[model samples]
Target: MKKNDWFLAAGIVIAAAVILLLQIFGSVQNGLTVTVSVDGSLYGTYSLSEDRQVEINDTNRIVIENGSVVMEWADCPDQLCVNHRSISRDGESIICLPNRVVVSIEGTDGKNEENSLDGIAG
Candidate 1:
């Protein structure tokens, strides 16, 4: 209602918007590799820059192309993983619950990948 109050409110709004934009842009950048895991075991890691198809334990197929990874095929019942969109951003993932498979993007810095925790485990 007061002039100072309006200025403070506008400043807060601008600050919040800047932080949100930074987070959005930061998450999608510097993701150079994709890591695949099956049944709680490490399966393989692939580069996003390279085009290839990875078959996971004869149950799921992962396709990497054009800086993105997608589940090309799967033997799981629901097919939810197959329908999911490709992941190219850091922290993005395509998980197949039935087959216990997870595919996630890994950033180049390695700090994000090394110290990350799996919340589902706890």
Candidate 2:
């Protein structure tokens, strides 16, 4: 093949790889958000389910209860919300970085809590 052809092929391959990575990340999860609010102050962000952090340090010292929703995981350096924990009820989630994903528990698209209890939904 010509040199130009090779270069073009390589470019296309690289572009395709980047697109695939984005798609995969976008589909990483499908949950809800549960923002944490301190004593009249806005905390960080978090997602439902997943074993993430709810607060950063003991400076504020906040926590969640039976209420199911997003919880911020403010410990990791990167702080990217991983699969985190797994929520199924009305509120439950994981958090990281400066984000806060919330889980509907009733399904991301709005199905029902029972449906999402198992794990990732369809």
Candidate 3:
């Protein structure tokens, strides 16, 4: 075998071992934290839990309540934005795209984020 081939094989083996170790010990997952800023102003930070809703006003005032969160009210005309639903998982979010009102669930940065958001993966 070429000298470079030996190094490549060793690198591959090391990578596999590390992956196996992570699986055995559980992969390190970054904690989830959410901070809401509405209309470029500081809204609030919310912790993850089931059946929780956070309501915000145009003035950036926020209210947190337990239960499925829905669009209680909005200043926008047509009231189309308040018809949206609630989110319960890490990746789930409700956004009034037209109103620029965004509610996002924070999770592991990249891989499996959507699944986490959807509450599919425990």
Which prediction has the highest TM-score against the true structure? Answer: 1
Per-model lDDT: 0.82, 0.44, 0.52
Report the C-alpha lDDT of model 2 over 1-122, residue by residue, as the tens digit: 79999999999998778665543433324455445544435555544544444544442222444434333334435634433553334333343434332322333444434443323331
Q: Which segments of candidate 3 are over 4 A away from where they belong?
A: 1-35, 39-42, 50-68, 108-122
Error of 1 at 26 (Å): 5.1
- Higher-scoring candidate on TM-score, 2 or 3: 3
TM-score of 3: 0.43
Most accurate candidate by lDDT: 1
**TM-score against truth, every candidate:** 0.71, 0.26, 0.43
**lDDT (10s digit) by residue, model 3, range 4-108:** 999999999987786555443332224443446566565666654443455666522223345223456667666665666654434445656556666655654
Q: Which candidate, 1 or 2, has the higher lDDT?
A: 1
Residue runs of model 2 more than 4 Å from their true location after superposition: 30-122
